[model samples]
Target: MVKLFNEPIILKCDHCGKDLFADSQMSIIVFVEDRKNKVIKDVYVCCKLECDRNLQEIKVKEGLIDGWKDLSDLTNPILFLNQIMATFNRMKNGWIFEPNAFEKLKEIYLACAQYVMREPTESEIKRASDILGLPF
Candidate 1:
């Protein structure tokens, strides 16, 4: 007998509206469960921390807390910036299956900006641009 996978026909990123390929390394899957209703809602997003953050925000707006890690832990600006660059470099070097490093970088950059309460400095932008070889 043969078995079949139950992949959804149309799985788009809950945060960025990007198409999510089944079982792809570039995809992040979140299963939110409601114990009272005994239902699980599957959330699919691209492999970016910003996407996860956005999903948590949306859930908070809806009064559902799934006990995700606190975003406040990323408050250290220098460390946060390092993480962004590392993730970007990995994606660019084909460590991750995603071809679009810009999307991932943009998401992380926006999150960093929000935390810092200011737009990215010219130097920061230039650094990222130099690494990715794309005009930021």
Candidate 2:
């Protein structure tokens, strides 16, 4: 799959009639879920305030939580950015992750971020393994 942060798409909010997205800015994050209700995959975006509010309302109605992690974990934006970039590299290098691998990686980043706040421990390693789908 060719992942390019390209042009934007406009979508309306279920609550209000408004342009939810704009071109060349940010697109709406369209994420997919699996049969078991696990997040299968996700895509990021830039959207309008109404759309954000609408999504929150719907998720609230369904009692769903946005599991997206903080992307500001890594101090250096370049290295932090490389985390997602490396996933694609690994895919091309034959380390293609499972369908929901990116989501797991996001969790891994969160774990690492927490580790950065305290003494590193074995649990962090376990989390890393789990994110990579490796047996502990």
- Model 2 poorest 10 in a row by lDDT: 1-10
Residue pairs in collision within model 2: 26-46, 27-45, 27-46
| Pairs of residues clashing in candidate 1 | none
Model 2 gets an lDDT of 0.41
Best by lDDT: 1
Model 2, backbone clash pairs (residues 3+ apart or across chains), number: 3
Q: What is the lDDT of residue 83 in candidate 1?
A: 55
- lDDT, model 1: 0.47
Candidate 1 Cα misplacement greater than 4 A, ranges: 1-10, 41-46, 60-136
Question: In order, what lDDT does every prediction score?
Answer: 0.47, 0.41
> Candidate 2: which stretches are off by over 4 Å?
1-37, 41-44, 59-61, 68-136
lDDT of 1 by residue, 48-86 (tens): 477777776665445333432123333357755765676
